[model samples]
Target: MTQRICGQVVRVEGPAFRVRGTDGTEWHGVVRGRLKKGKRTATAPVCIGDEVEVTPLSEGQAVIERVLPRRTCLVRRTPLGGRRTHGKAPPVQVLAANVDVVVIVVPAPAVRSTVIDRFLQVASSGGVQPVLCVNKMDLVPEPAARQHVAEVVTPYIRSGIPVVLTSAATRQGVDELAALLRGNLVAFIGPSGAGKTSLLNALCPGLDLRTREVDARGRGRHTTTTSAIYDIGGALVVDTPGLREVAFALDEKDAGDPLLLFEDIAGLAARSRFQDCSHVHEPGCAVKAAVACGELDEARYREYLRLRRALERSPSD
Candidate 1:
């Protein structure tokens, strides 16, 4: 008879996963029948940081019996965008699982904040913390660009989320960022040239992680080809391939709290004459008033409105 137990997966190796139990021992195991049965909830069913039930078949090997209910899941949208839901079902894509924080990295000087906004919106929709990391600050040479970065990230910080500024080159803010991810499964996400890998190298040196130069337009070549987790002392950090696009749609069920993500809009939205006010062009919109009265940056407010629109157009009805 096999002894059944429960553990959390710290790393996913080819066919075997490194699972650590509450007792602090390690087991190399394979996914059991139940969890292997294809799940659409996440990009990868056996993602790093997943808590699973297992049965030990050997001294160092076990079979995963079940993946326990996750407290938080971090996911992204498909880049191809062929599916349609039109009030039917959500056209969502899963990226990872049980991530306490979704670290959304973005290159500096991105005028639209599209990359950052899109990731934060998804994190908000997934009930996870979106930690905005503006990487490559060392490369952003202009004062205006730096100002834009601060402006775009101010709302999230004011709302109690921590936005970290980092530069792998000078090891700037590396310790602070590492502390945030310590003891929690934090996923690093960003487009190709946002310095995700560089930051990883800074935080965990001696690994000699590969890095490529970002093009003139700030596009970086892919250095990370898969989603892998690294153990730093007692913490787990997941480094994934460079992302090109972040889907704006989320599942119809248990989608994240939009009000919480865009908390600033709540005041005006509730007071609007229309219960269904989109807040874009609605009359008597208080959200708009705040922006005009120097309460919010024009760009930041626009990004919020875009997120609200993306949510509305989401495949889930």
Candidate 2:
């Protein structure tokens, strides 16, 4: 007789899910009814990294009867701008679910805070931990580049968010990065060409994932089209492709939901003044204060404010 068990979804395709149970086997399971009824969302519900309950029907078949409440999730608006989203952007796209840490990889100093900050906002809403990992440290070892990274990423670091400078080429911070992700499920997210795939290859040699060069025109050719789960020994990382969507969330209704992610920002933002404060211009904004007092990166602060304003003007927000 087959056994029933709870599993964490490592991958999702259509309504089928690739889940890993505590028994250490990957199973193909379909969602149960009650779980779907609860969400009632426009976008298809199941996402990579979801924790669910599965009952075996046969050797390779199982039914997903329920989705155990997710401790964290990363969500975004759909690509097409629409009014259907109510006050903010329309529909939430869950890149991955139930992740413990969100590892944001970006280029040193040149890393755009607007993108990172927006990511922070999404993660904060999901109740996940965020870490800034600066890749290509080899290119920025000298004065200008190195100083730029320091100035830009300081804010996140000051917020108790771990910031690690790394070089996938020289293997500079690979060990440290691996150690940090050891025994935890970390979700790697960033724009194209940030060296996330390269870093993954470094951590688990011979994995050989495809990558591209950044164009002279300054735009990165998007790679890693879909989200994938990579397991390196004891550490498992969920690698998400570049975010093609630009929708904002409504009213921060999920603000208090533990299922939502982004604890780092929420923890700090809660101390800020104004219950509805967007963390942009409100007096006594702790987020801004961190930037002004050299506790946060100015570039990050500016970008965070920009996203804040965008969210403010966004539909349903």
Candidate 3:
């Protein structure tokens, strides 16, 4: 007779999963066919940090029977040309489930506001708190360079998001970062070369994960190829592979207004004279006025428009 037990999926590698059972046993498992074929919009039915039921077969192998409902999930739009249903839009990719926070890490001297905005939207939409982690501060040793980085993140700070500047090599701001992550399940995400793994090493000290240097073009070489959960200090940290693009999946209801994460813009929009103001050529648009008068960060406003247009073009299937 097979014994059924509950476990949390700690790592996902293609069709294989590593689940840590409630009894402290580790099981290598695969999802049941029925669960895999369910009518879900997610590319994969299982992800790291998911609670699941498994039936132990023999040795350390098990079959994942069911996935418990997720309290929160981090997701992104599947890349174009992926598997489609009747030529419909691509499904979303579930990155992690039941996460308390999504940390968007970016390297100093190369901060990209567009990427940060996209990640913020997805985290907010998924009901997870978002924190900005500026890593590799050692790369920006000059005072002017450091100030430049500060200016880049000022808008996010003004929007009430927590921003931490860290350098894995020098241990700068590691204590503060650790404080925010203590006792919480946090997922670190960012483009390649942002030092997610390095920060993890700095925080846990001795779990020396792999590290790769950025290319000559200043692009990060992929170091972490898979997503996995680690128990670091008092925090459960999920370290994921670097992402090149962060397109978000949106529900039909959310398609009309994609500014849910942009509080500054949303607040201004509420005061617009026209109820349906697009903030582009609409007369008396509060958002546009704010941008023109320097009341709002112009770069952030431009990125918001870019994201809105991208969402408008997204296919809802």
Q: Pick the candidate with the highest lDDT.
A: 3
- Writing each residue's lDDT as its tens digit, candidate 3 over 237-263 gives 998888877776667678646678788
Cα displacement (angstroms), candidate 2, residue 300, comes to 7.5
Model 3 spans > 4 angstroms off:
1-3, 81-86, 288-303, 313-317
Model 1 clash pairs are 43-94, 125-256
lDDT of 1 by residue, 120-169 (tens): 77787777877888887887778988887788777677667788988888
Tens digit per residue, CA lDDT, model 2, 70-143: 77778777766545644543567777887888888887646766667767766676667888889988877679
TM-score of each: 0.84, 0.78, 0.90
Number of clashes recorded per candidate? 2, 21, 0
Go through the candidates in order and give each one's C-alpha lDDT: 0.74, 0.73, 0.88
Worst 10 residues of 3 by lDDT: 80-89
Q: What is the lDDT of residue 81 in candidate 2?
A: 50
Best TM-score among the predictions, by candidate number = 3
Which residue runs of candidate 2 sit more than 4 Å off their true CA positions? 1-3, 13-16, 32-39, 81-89, 215-217, 244-246, 254-307
